[model samples]
Target: MTDSRDVVRRLREGFAWRDTPVGVFADLSGWWRDPELLRMLGPSLAGLHADASPTVVAGIETRGLVLGPLAALPLGVGFVEVRKEYRVAGEGQRDGADPMLRAGTPPGYQDGGLTLIAPRRLFRPGDRVLLVDEWIETGAQASAVRRMVDEAGADWAGVAVIVAACPPEVGERLGVKALVTDDQLPG
Candidate 1:
């Protein structure tokens, strides 16, 4: 087993900050490229909530899509995707034929709200779901996901993330577990 500290150190080593026209953005490409880091990520995050014995892992679209399965595979649970409602050029917001559970997020660090949707059938009543994501900056999306879980009558097992950059209160409220805190990142 890899030491938790070692995993965190490796993650930090792989993380970088890139400046774009908009502003500084976190570049986590290094984390995805490192083979050892990839192997460790799932188990490390899942270990945090092993006691919870989550029945399923739910990942938000984008980065969460990658991390969710990694965590779920070790936990012996299935994975579910929570996608953002997207608008195509010709069509408006896209909605599939399958019934979806949707929730609107509060304004987050990005200063924009999004609608998170997932197939209603994926979640069942009494299921314990653990959400896995790369980062939690405002807990807005996480909060929305929690609401969706509630709508499905499933229990929230809590959240596991690579980094916890949200406020202390938010972290406490959401039951967040993380490999590293914001302050631990390179300046």
Candidate 2:
């Protein structure tokens, strides 16, 4: 089986690197400009799904949308999206409590006190979930998602990211294996 390092190499060959909106940072994306590259990277991300051992794949909004399902495909698991698109005055039966509105969060997004909402209740009690993202920096988002999964009595199987910039403790604190390391990311 190909290792994570090999996978990163494959990704680099298959995608284009671009700067984030901040104009001072860069990240890799599956190249829309190159079909062959997309073909390569899509499957590459999917390959991580197998390594993750997840009953379902959960992803954050925005960047996570790009990879959540792709990673789930290889694991033969369903996909879930954790987003704050709705508002709840209190903790409802299905919908979580409304996020505490922050000073700088988006208009519709509430703090949710760091709760994660799985898309359509994709996860169940004791379900093993593999969380995925394109990048993991501070790990706040992933941590919030894990808390939600745990509160629902689910198991966090592991976390896979294309780029992991945080130190090892971040994964430990979040209670997951950093399946891919910074050295394994496309450089």
Candidate 3:
């Protein structure tokens, strides 16, 4: 049987890990430049959908955009974008105004470079959300998204990442399931 751990390992190996710079920003952004990275992660992410229980997916903006929808589709659930642009969190702000305005990444994320939004649009009061992202090295983005989910009054079902550089211990603190490890990436 195919296990999640194996799947994670496979996804990690899909990327050209050797090409990434040692720093956090460079490492994260560098993954985007490698086409093979996505090719590898895409299938592994699909595997996540196949194995997961039914649930709505909350994708982190920009990066998580693709990962979120792909996973949710297999589960027959709707996908929502958790934006990094900031908008006021209250009524009378013009519904459907600018979704991106309020959906920013969080402060202190990736060394405090990213700021997440205060409002979450794709959730109901009691909705269950499974947060998915491209990778989780520091958990900054994941934590930021979690805060947004909580602010939206949605229940966080779980967290899934395509690659996890830190071990399970680090992931556990941020409610992350490192479906794959950094070492799994191609050298």
Q: Pick the candidate with the highest TM-score.
A: 1
lDDT of each: 0.91, 0.61, 0.62
Alpha carbon lDDT at 63, candidate 1: 90
Per-model root-mean-square deviation over C-alphas: 2.3, 6.1, 5.3
Per-residue lDDT over 138-180 for candidate 1, one digit per residue giving the tens place of the 0 to 100 score: 8999999999999999999999999999999999899999999
Question: Would you estimate the TM-scores of all the predictions?
Answer: 0.92, 0.66, 0.66
Error of 1 at 114 (Å): 0.7
lDDT of 2 at 92: 51
- What is the model-wide C-alpha lDDT for candidate 1? 0.91
Residue range 37-142, candidate 2, lDDT tens digits: 4444435655654554668887777767767777776567788877653443254555573333111222333333334455434567878877777777667777
Candidate 1 residue spans exceeding 4 A from truth: 87-96, 107-109
Clashes of each: 0, 2, 26
What is residue 84's positional error in candidate 1, in angstroms? 0.5
